[model samples]
Target: MDVTVNGQLTQVPFGLSVADLVRGRLPDPRSVAVAVNGAVVRAGDWERTQVGPGDAVEIVTARQGG
Candidate 1:
């Protein structure tokens, strides 16, 4: 299936959950926030949130500064 990740178009396997994507891409899942289709998804809900074609996904991670 095709979905947009951080404003970029990408293809991912079917039945891939938000948790799976975060865990696969980020070294620390606890430091990131996810939003799917304009809705902010809590960390606990990532396992239940599934990505589909044309879905908009935004992943933001915390960065150290100052």
Candidate 2:
């Protein structure tokens, strides 16, 4: 299946959960925020939230700056 991730089109396996996606992309899932189809998904729900094809996903990472 194809979905947009952070503005880029990418292919992912079917029934892929947000948690799986995050773990595959980032070293620390704790430092990132995720949204799908313009709605924010809570951290606790990541495991149950599945991303469907043609969905828009945005994974934003936190950065410390002064």
Candidate 3:
């Protein structure tokens, strides 16, 4: 299946969970926020959040600045 991540097109395996994606990209998946199809997904729910083809995923990480 194919999904868009941060506006880029990418192919992912079927039945891929949000947690799997995060773990693949970030060393600390807990430090970021995730949204799928414009709805925010809670951290605790990432493991259960399945992403399918044509879905849009936006992942943002926290940054400390002064």
Candidate 4:
């Protein structure tokens, strides 16, 4: 299925969880924030939160800049 990630179109396998997505991209998934379909998903829930097709995923990493 197709989903939008950080405003880009991307294809992901079915039954993909938020954790899986994060792990695939970032070396430190815990240092980022994730939102799916406009709802912020808690870090603890990432492992169970499944991203469906057509869902908009916004992943932002925390930067240490003023």
- Top TM-score: which candidate number? 2
Worst 10 residues of 1 by lDDT: 22-31
lDDT tens digits by residue: candidate 2, 1-66:
999999999999999999999999998888799999999999999999999999999999999998
Candidate order by lDDT, decreasing, is 2, 4, 3, 1
- Positional deviation of residue 55's Cα in model 2 after best superposition, in angstroms: 0.4
* TM-score, every prediction: 0.93, 0.96, 0.94, 0.95
Residue-wise C-alpha lDDT for candidate 4, range 1-66, written one tens digit per residue: 999999999999999999999999899876799999999999999999999999999999988988
Off by over 4 Å in 3: none
Model 3 alpha-carbon miss at residue 56, Å? 0.1
Q: What's the lDDT of the predicted structure labeled candidate 4?
A: 0.95
Assess each prediction's global lDDT (C-alpha) against the native.
0.93, 0.97, 0.93, 0.95
lDDT of 3 by residue, 1-66 (tens): 889999999999999999999998899876799999999999999999999999999999999998
* lDDT, residue 3, candidate 3: 96
Off by over 4 Å in 1: none
* Per-residue lDDT value at 64 in model 2: 95
